[model samples]
Target: MNIQNIEPKYEILLDTICKTYETGKIKAFNAVNTELVQTYWEIGKYIVEFEQNGAKKAEYGKALLEQLSRDLSIKYGKGFSRSNLFQIRAFYTKFPKIQTVSGKLSWSHIVELIKVSDDTEREFYEKQAVIENWSVRELKRQKDSGLFLRLGVGKDKKEVLTLAKSGQIIDKPKDILKNPYIFEFLKIPEPYHIAETQLESLLCDNLQSFLLELGRGFTFVGRQYKITLNNIHYKVDLVFYHRILRCFVLIDLKINEVRHQDIGQMNMYLGYFANEENIEGDNPPIGIILSKEKDELLVEYATYGMNSQLFVQQYQFYLPNKDELREEIESVLRGDNEIII
Candidate 1:
């Protein structure tokens, strides 16, 4: 035991043992987590059942939870606070059929989903969470950014329903689009007027968060992806490959309102990528012009005759107005406006 010199195979043996130990720990933790979630669901179910059988349902509402919280805390120790119990109860109420609940999501993720009052919106996030394995924090950010609305607004009603039921499916170029892409994670400074190059650099610095905001199936190709046509050179601000769509996505950043010339520039980039960059099995490239401001009329005309698949969207430095967006979505659902994309 005291020998200073170790055998050649000793390190390998120790490494294998360490890996096995870590793997076992992870498996055990997951098993415990699953059981814990199931137990919470049962508790919620029992609470609801008890209230139904009570003489006065109102008596079993607040008072029942308060007494249960005190008793559970005293007997089982922490994690049974009134707020936590409320969440547990709501979890059951929201998802009565335990079979429908996702086994992939953690309790924290479920808590965040429970806060989403809209049934369709909550279902979208739940399915997306299970499919994408989004962390609790990521789920919160997406909800705050009004991802459901972004995907559903101005989109076909049936497609929106499918998206809600099955998370996001990238069947076509527009499936990956998010209007007014949120970049609050970049944390731009006081003046809030960052140059295009500066914005690109900040995006790189926060690449992970940026990719999450970008949605599913995007892999970074390169920054300042260059293309040369007839001795003149141009750079796309960001280049990403969509694994699902099997296409190249080129994005350009603009600090000012997007001009018609900017739209033409992105079309050129897409043309270059489609003809010159695409491989034998690759699909046509898609271009996105992300600007600080855009005129719907201007963009409509700028992209009117373009052959290459191009999109003009806004990029805000901060989170969007969630309440306003939510109201818009509610209005749409109520048949106030039937806008199509």
Candidate 2:
């Protein structure tokens, strides 16, 4: 048979093969996600029941898990380790309510949530992970890097807890700001050379993780979103619509340290969105400047008395040492002590 004469038949076969491959891939992905999530839910149920039934037996839960692990590993195989069982127990304790676990997050994400000691912080990260569709690795890095503590440190405990349990309920503008945004998902080195364009590109490439770090309800609208004021064109680094907040989230990325001018620019962006794009029933647009560093005094002065909603937050390309972040939190708490002479 001449090769050229067979070309049409070969092309049809190739197209069918590609279609079948894609269908199989989709089915496999769904199967794996469903299996992992269901397993975690069952583990949570067992742990909760074990604790309730055997409260008088000091080592009952541990012994039960050990025997169950051995039996399950022998019969079914992988992911039945003693440590994983402990994680499942912790998962139940952390999120007792089934409704709290969103379908988008897998058991792997829940495993990362087990490491968070603070219940409020754990809930916040979990909700954000599901809402933003964060990968398990991204979830782990964000939790380990102290993202929640950094955001919730100065906030009222009750209000912060409410946000964690429910989700971003932005009754006030300040509620939308996370003081120090974690960007370890980009896998960039800290204190390394990088430009604004590079940062913007990395964020857009990993926009899902960026949204997770930003918190819940953020939907990516565009990058370098263009706007014009009086014939002058300006581009916002990233644009998002926050479903829960019912407003646009205009993010401006800065490579160098933040300045008053950055805040002014963000305020202008917010004003434009409010006046030009805001619709009925929509709240005022929120502006955030994500920079390498920020001066607290400068941010206070720049945002003070300005009605337009604006925030200045620092972003770290690398995960800081966990101990270092904890120590810093302790130092800040101590500094807040009002010393009586």
Candidate 3:
């Protein structure tokens, strides 16, 4: 009887209807995407089988893709270009088993994946893309950033292969750590100097890229997190909670090379966190001292036999040559030393 009250009810009903319709449309789109990928794979298989057959083997030469594209486009209208057919063929070659294909990932995502030549590396990227819910652009960013190569640098050949086959496994504080963390996304130029505060500010400004560089399961907590002990105050540069590790990560930034005092300071931070911040269910907090450079011998001697979970690693403002970094990592592995955490 009351028009105004009834109008509110109608609005609610309309909202629900629109949401349900949108949800259904999304479901339909996902189903169609999955089916389209499956269709492409089947078509690729057919083409491969035709070429393998004695009669059609020679016919499927240089002009095979062009002929197929023309005929398919003539029948089906569009989306069957030579490039697409080539991609479809490559897709099949990359993932021959349909069971391996993820329905959640669209053909656009797989198009980027097919470019990866190594089976383990491809598997790693796919797993990470799904786990991290990376968009097509994000996936491309990871690829261009040489994420797999970055992870493999410090590991032995076997460990590197395992990393590719299986995404990062975070059993310990050391597992998630990377040396010389890349921050080229900040758009900072090479041979430039920036203060620690400015560096922290830039990282916070580009938090998404920073998190991607940090890897999976990390959620931001705060910056300049302050703690007081014995009437003295200290502030941490950045703080993050690692969901998988079940611990708080405290990072301190330095523009210069890491010194023993830096490690000692991180040790103190870890102590404060483990004592004051960690609850009953939480693990001991980990501390990272991020500097532009670290003296390896000093790091080894300083960190050795330290009870606290403190790690010192270098950070780069620009992207280093992947091949050079790869070689550096392999060279370090030859020494059979624990990787710089």
Candidate 4:
């Protein structure tokens, strides 16, 4: 046997062995995660049942959790703190139906969720986490950043409750809009000046994080997409297609404050897409103008008469403070009430 030929065979054998071992490890990790989640769910059910049938006492609940934690930790060896047991109890109280929790979310995700007091907010986070396949950290970030409160603003109480309980319904255009979109992934400095080119490039580079920021159903298409109308060439900053809406999404980038002209330009781009690029049976294309600043009045005036679907939204390079964002959202809802009054 030639030494050179033997080297190739040895490398190939090593590679196969390594890959097979890695695959087995991955499967084992997944199985462990699934089992952990199931155990937590069962623990939650037991806690709820104990409160209902056995204890029926507040102090007893605490004592029972401590005792249970000690016993479970001795047998299971880890992940059975008294606080965690309480969290499991709260989890059952919040989501009595196990069927509602998608298998995509693990026990760690539910532990973070159990902290939310509002049932609607809890459900919204749960559904969004499941649908988005959000990591445990992402779930915590969204909750801490007040994503549910921000998205729930401007909606009626019933609508808010429905969205919180069942997640956003994609039946209407407004359903896609997320007020104060979470941008924790960006990690940009606060009050920093960013160019449109820079923003577009960053988003394109971190397309997965950008899609999560853009809410759901968005699949990246391309950047600087060229189109022609009457021999006049125009370029859209970014283009995406939404699977749920079944339409092309034309995104225009704006660095400075958004003006009526920006919205108008986006409308024109959307109109061109609807008439030219959109295929038969495809929904009319939607245009989104992403700017550092957007005036609500300007957006309303620009989109008032246009048959084309257009939206002007402000983009932040960094995540907003949770307390401030929550308050802002609440204030917006109050302003809506005043307008109604």
lDDT, candidate 4, equals 0.78
Can you write out model 2's per-residue Cα lDDT over 1-341, one digit (the tens) per residue?
77657686887887899999999998888778767776777787887786787765758878878988999899989888888878877777777776656767677777777777866567778776765567787677667777666665565545556657765555566766765777877888645788899989988888767776776667999999999999999999999998888999998988877888878888889989999999999999988888887788988887899855777778777665667555544455455433558
Per-residue lDDT tens digits for candidate 4, residues 1-341, read 66657686887787899999999998888788777777777878977877788767889888888999999999987788998888878877777787777777778887888888756568789888876778998788778767787677667656776777677678756678776565557677867667778878887888887786677888888999998888999889999998899998888888888888777778888888888888977898888787777788877887898854788876666666667655644554456444553
lDDT of the structure predicted as candidate 3:
0.85
2 or 3, greater by lDDT: 3
Maximum-lDDT candidate = 1
- Whose TM-score is greatest here? 1
lDDT of each: 0.87, 0.76, 0.85, 0.78
TM-score of 1: 0.93
Candidate 1 ranges beyond 4 A from true positions: 1-12, 55-59, 189-191, 338-341
lDDT of 4 at 242: 87
Model 3, runs deviating above 4 Å: 1-4, 7-12, 54-60, 324-341
Model 3, position 139: C-alpha lDDT score: 94
Task: Using lDDT, rank the candidates from best to worst.
Answer: 1, 3, 4, 2
Q: What RMSD does model 3 have?
A: 3.8
* Residue pairs with backbone overlap in model 4: none
